[model samples]
Target: MTTFLQLHLLTAYPPSNPNRDDQGRPKQATVGGAPRLRLSSQSIKRALRVSEPFRQGLAGHMGQRTKLMAKVLLDRLLAGGMDAAQARTKAEEIAKVFGKIEPQDKKRPEAVQGTTLAFISPDERAFALDLADKALAGEALPTDKELARTVLRTADGAVDIAMFGRMLADNPDFNRDAAVQISHAITTHRAQAEDDYFTAVDDLQRREDTGGAHLGEHGFGSGVYYLYACVNCDLLVENLGGDKELAARGLRSLVRAIATATPSGKQNSHAHHPRAGYVRAEIGGAAPRDLTGAFFTPVRGDDLFDASARALERTAADIDRAYGPAADAVETMDVPKGQGTLAAIEDFAASALERQNA
Candidate 1:
């Protein structure tokens, strides 16, 4: 039986556009026939991957998502005294191991990027760069499949790639399945984006100038958001090449990041940095299920955070009653009630790996 770790969080943000839509406004979703602010799973995962906790904890075991592999290789080769023409040719060969090379941009002819962004592990990046150095030294390198086999990896100490997975369209065999699944966070209560209009004064304005320098308006919203995530502990360990110790560390870092990280959308202007007010962590062999149904009818009360927490607890109990217990054990950190601490939750989630071994 596959063991699973599930996390549910309630965080309150005050008038900030953490995630925006194409119109540059806070993203919104209709739930229970009411509009609510939303934070996309993509945005949440990115925030967690880049959070200080993840960076500090995982350090060298992280991957970078970028399209500049070819450009970076080309620059390195040229700096190593390789001819520019030869460098470009060799760089394209190595870069194609990851993805298709993009057409040279007319505006920036020197920039050579991939058609699609590639998620590359640090080890893979170093390997590609080493190949570039070898080419500069006039070494005859392997071609095509041989080159890709040397450069690509199924799992190469990249915690983020192991958790979120990656797809190499050109080399499907090198793809990895995600071990962690995240849901788009949505407000527990009905909320709508409100426009914030303001004018900025010019610092060097003349005394005679009466009008402001610039005028703009953007959308913002305030509410308690409920976020859900599930981690396949078995798959996580497998993705990390069966390194249980690294898997435990990744889980701990992930929990901390999810509790503290906020999407960086207009954060400078709003400064909306709020930690999760409540977090529930569960571990078990039972199939994973989300508690989003708790807020099917938008929660409403004077203390929105408290009310939302109650709704989540009540929903979990009701579900257990209906379907027998879904989790073997559970831990929670409730700021309002002061029930548990984040450290306890982290330990509880990591214990899943140990339980699986038993």
Candidate 2:
């Protein structure tokens, strides 16, 4: 049996484009013929990874998802009293192990960027930098294979790397497969794009200058989103090098972030700092299931936020009743006002996850 951890969350966002389409409107998808607002899985994951609570949980055990590999390496070398020009050159060689370098200057001066943001942890970067320093000092360096092993090895691939995984195109052998799956969040009801038309008055505007100095329109919308994510605990542990304890801790942090982190889109205007009004947690060795079917017919109500959450809860109950319980342990955190609190949900999830490894 494969252990799985799953969450169904309902979050309400105001008239703001947290996730936008190419046209700058709230992202939307046609669901069952009705257009529904959407927040992409990529956006949601990035937000959670950078959230304050999530970062605090992982502490310094985090990877830098940046293209600035040369800069990172050069910083280390320069700190060790190496000359700037030499450090830049060596950094390029070291960075080549990870991916292609996009030198900042067309003249190929010094600074370089990785092909993409390679998700390498701080320790891994340090190791690679040290290896470069040794090579520069005429010290005997390890073979290429041994050097790759030394640089790629880690305690747990850092928190973000373990959960989201990384793909080093330069060396596919070091790639870590992601054990967590995220479903793009979609609203439970139809939503239409709305535009906010406004004008900004220039401080030096004269009374004869008429209405305003600048006028433009911004797009936004509101919806109650149904978000889902699944974590294969066994695979996650394997991804973290068979550390079940660390995997469990990572699961808890992930759940907490999922419940609280809102993508920092146009927050100054929308201010969408929403927590899940409801979360249904399922922990089992059974196959994970998503309750997106609950909104196939669209839930309509005067109070859509509460209605959306209620609809999800009803669907989960209906499925369990008909399918004879699809999970080993299931818990629902009804976090609407007096029903429960976010803290309570986090506690419930943590306790339940702890039981899985035990």
Candidate 3:
């Protein structure tokens, strides 16, 4: 059983520069016009993946895909009786079919283009392109099979954090998106506090107050946080082939496998010294905390993976209690539910089965 779990984080206090056109204050949107915090969606997602839990669980797969597709294709070509050169060519072709470019575009860095090819094998790439060409020509094609195959092949692939996703999956009451959004909000709130602390503190003032609020050993800021994540078992199965009932069963099996598997742990350590600069607050003012680095001292990859798995198992029990057994079948699995999009998928899968049985 395999599944694709995606985690997204949005800052609660998305910041906005004072709406002043080089003059007096202008009307700004969002809750009382209190200046908002600033952080990109990409930034939050990246941070989550780099969190101790995700780094520990999935490891390098979450960050880099440099030669993944090339490797996939090379293996395929060997299986298909092609020589090294021929295999490479076929792999490139397959990559191209799956939206990966060959020979690297000049405007784009090789690193960026290479990442695209890291996920697919040459044969699958070739199949996908062939499927597309046939569709364009009005020829019968195997779209579902290709999608299913891709999902199956990458079943164990950990491309992102699972903790957040696992939480959403296990707890039917939990809203995955809302959870991520809240996490982002918390980080945003922390970031703003740090920014304010930097603004307020000076060498002379710190000395005046016995260096209490002075920036200490920590360099970047402790407000920064890393979030590890995982998704539910059924969710993964559904994403792979768009099948709900099958996914739910897969999810159950996954839970069993996880129970038997050795647990993983996080490795990254806070980079800066514990005594760092003070953070400004919305009301209570400045306070000191450790400064987590931009990279967060490279936490262990195992921690991230383990956290997600654990979170998912707990979440699953909760979900079953609230949603009951997923009663749908495979085909109509995309319609999402109340933050429980995965369960909604299960319902659809069950429904499909009922129709088939009827």
Candidate 4:
């Protein structure tokens, strides 16, 4: 059975759009008969994947999530001393091995593209690039190219691809199930959507020209939010070609990323990026739980941070009482002023992996 790593986080933001809706307002949902600020799994994962801590830590061990697979391979072929026309033909042929490529068009016939976004890693692009080089040399093509199962094995080296997984509709065999599951962050207390009305004064305008150059209103809200994530160690290892050591490193980096990173949605206008006020890291039964249940009644205390922490403790105790205990190893951290140290959190996460490996 796979060991599961679950992280429970409580963070507070002050009037920021960590995640926004199509209308350019903070995303929200009605919960417990009251509106709660929302942050999608996509935004949360993207933030974590691109976080400086993740980049600095994983450095060369990550993947680029884009549709530039074709372009990437084409560039590599040209650098290998191939002529332009031969490089383009071989590149598209190899690109077709990954996903359906749009036919060459008059607008930009030389450059090919996938039908949609393909979360290909640099390693995968390099692998395809080698294939194109072989095709140029008139070598035999890979018989397995027709089946994506053989072409999509580059997940072994890409941290983001292995953790978040990939989906290729053109070939389901290449799909790698996500080892990590991140939930939408929901506000602990009910909140009302607030507005900020401001105008940009034109730098070139004379004093008598106009009152303001441009005027507009934007939506925002402030609240303490609960975020949850679970990492399946076995699946993570499997995604990385059964490299337990690398997977452990990934989990360690991911914990630091979660503890430090905040979504960069409207930070320029509303710089409200704050880390988790409270964190609960646990290596529990496969059945994972989130403390969103604790806010069912909506915490009503002068100190929402401490109140949220207490509710989490109480709810966790209640679960153990009713469900015969869930955690094998558990640790808690609270930064009431949003200044929690992550040293213990990182050590705790790595210890879980070590224990599982043991």
lDDT of each: 0.94, 0.79, 0.31, 0.80
Model 3, poorest ten-residue lDDT window? 276-285
Tens digit of per-residue lDDT, candidate 3, span 1-358: 2222222211111122211222222221221223322323334344444445345544433323244554555565556565666555554544442344456456742222333423332233455455434433445433433443432232223333122232212112322221122122212112222222223355566444653554523112222122222343334433333444443343332222221221111102222212101110110111211111212222224343233223333443464466552222112111111132333433332232233313
Give the least accurate 10-residue stretch of model 4, judged by summed lDDT.
142-151
TM-scores, one per candidate: 0.97, 0.91, 0.31, 0.92
Model 2 lDDT tens row, 238-264: 777777666766777888899889778
TM-score of predicted structure 4: 0.92
Candidate 1 RMSD to the real structure: 1.3
Worst lDDT 10-window in candidate 1:
102-111
Best by lDDT: 1
Instruction: Give the higher-lDDT candidate: 1 or 4.
Output: 1
Residue pairs with colliding backbones in model 4 are none
Q: Candidate 3: which stretches are off by over 4 Å?
A: 1-32, 36-41, 47-52, 55-68, 71-87, 103-183, 186-237, 240-358
Question: Residue by residue across 148-244, what tens digits does model 1's lDDT show?
Answer: 8889888768999999999999999999999999999999999999999999999999999999899999999999999999999999999899899
Better of 1 and 2 by TM-score: 1
Model 4: residues with Cα > 4 Å off, grouped in runs: 78-86, 144-150, 337-340
Between candidates 3 and 4, the one scoring higher on lDDT is 4
User: What's the TM for model 2?
Assistant: 0.91
lDDT of 2: 0.79
Q: All predictions: root-mean-square deviation over Cα?
A: 1.3, 2.3, 17.4, 2.4
